[model samples]
Target: MKLEPFLLEILVCPQCRAPLNEADYDGHPELVCTAADCGLAYPVRDGIPVLLVDEARRPV
Candidate 1:
């Protein structure tokens, strides 16, 4: 996921209210919230963010 710098700055963890970071999955990039306390990662596909927990996949 190629999130704009401005957008990334404002993105928050839906579960933890923490900051976000970028994580790569099998060469596929995504925006993730690593609030260790939350233990969930939000994904982005085809330039669209899939923020649902059910839509997310475990890193392979």
Candidate 2:
């Protein structure tokens, strides 16, 4: 699924309030926190972004 550029531009990491960058995770689209200290990855399911910190995946 494709996230709108406008939405992506406004989305931030719930963990650190850092801007989120678009990336691919397991062949699916995801949003990754730009803060190196946080390194959280939020998944997008059915065009909806799951931005909860508890739901975010830690960087590998």
Candidate 3:
């Protein structure tokens, strides 16, 4: 599912509170932290952002 532009604008990283950028993770669209050190990818399920840190995926 696709996230709305307005929602994307308000979403931020849970770890660093940094701004998130639109990205693709595991063939699914997600909101990835912009901070290079905090590479957390928050999944978008059913067009809703799963912002929980425990549910976040870190880049290898």
Best by TM-score: 2
Q: lDDT by residue for model 3 over 1-60, one digit each (tens)?
A: 566778778888989989988888668988889999998998888777889999999887
Per residue, candidate 2 scores C-alpha lDDT tens digits across 17-57 of 99998889889878999998999999888878999998889
Candidate 2 lDDT: 0.89
- Candidate 1 vs candidate 2, TM-score winner: 2
* Pairs that clash in candidate 3: none
Better of 2 and 3 by TM-score: 2
By TM-score rank, best first, the candidates go: 2, 3, 1
lDDT winner between candidates 1 and 2: 2
- Local distance difference test scores for all models: 0.71, 0.89, 0.86
Better of 2 and 3 by lDDT: 2
In model 1, which regions exceed 4 Å deviation? 57-60
TM-score of each: 0.73, 0.90, 0.85
Which scores better on TM-score, 1 or 3?
A: 3
lDDT comparison, 1 vs 3, better candidate = 3
Which runs of model 2 end up more than 4 angstroms from their true locations?
none
lDDT, model 1, position 40: 64
Worst 10 residues of 1 by lDDT: 51-60
